[model samples]
Target: MKPVIRLATAFSILATGCAFGAEQHVVCPARLEPDAVQPNRPPSGWQLHMLRPVYLTEGGMLHGPPAESAFLVPDGGTSRKVGKQSGETQHWSFDVPHGYTKWMYCGYGGGGATLKLFRQVAEGATECTLSSQSADGVIKEVVEFVCK
Candidate 1:
């Protein structure tokens, strides 16, 4: 059963105190190499030197996890991995480094984090989606806007 909290109560609580890192969940999705055999966590590839992390509004069934989290969590946290595909439209990609093939992807929400992906399509080709959900069921679509 869903816990019931009065609107007034919520307002009172939020108004009373605001916690740091509460909105720091929305994060860049991870990516793995095409031939990678490992699962869980970001493949050794998903790397961003300047993520410029920001927080956006997260929408969910009210039962969703916090924004910047994950959509379908396995153990905890958000990550990704993938296999080689014929087409290049896949939302996932990677950069090979350290002699090991590492995959890479730019997503608005948590993408390519699943051991096996269901949807690998993104909105933009070169640009990462500005709005995406997390594995924890958190919605961080409005992160950029919120930060702005």
Candidate 2:
């Protein structure tokens, strides 16, 4: 089945070319298979932390550890950076396919990982809001925004 990329929080799928009327829609979701991927650097074996890894066989991202955790916010969120303690960066880059609306992500932080979805833009790629959720379900932090 084609995975539906709902906001999981919001109700907008901009990739579908639909004017959201407070209802979420579906566009194709990216196939994020790690085993089928080639590394841009070396896999850190860390959770959800893709190294200068090649995403979707097109682009590659390199990360440097973040200082404080970040989150994807509403109404104007675009790319986000999550930091690690080992001077390593837990970066996220989306090379979404055409007709793809939402970018579905499932990640967990060791201490607590921040999750963000890049907001949309007219030119180039837009980013989503960043929300924080821990791996072990022990902690939950506030979801930050670009405005505040």
Instruction: Please give, for residues 18-103, the per-residue lDDT of candidate 1 as tens digits.
Output: 14413212222233233223223443676323233322223111112222233321111233423321111112122212333211
Q: Residue 93 of model 1: what lDDT?
A: 24
Alpha-carbon runs more than 4 Å astray in model 1: 1-22, 34-148
Question: Model 2, 1-148: lDDT tens per residue?
Answer: 1112233433234343223323222221132333322234443553333333222111111111122223222333234334421111122333445654333333322233232223332212333223332222322332221111
TM-score of each: 0.17, 0.22
User: For model 1, what is the C-alpha lDDT against the true structure?
Assistant: 0.24
Count of clashing residue pairs in every prediction: 20, 18
Q: Which regions of candidate 2 are displaced past 4 Å?
A: 1-15, 20-22, 26-33, 43-70, 73-110, 114-148
In model 1, how large is the Cα lDDT of residue 73? Answer: 15
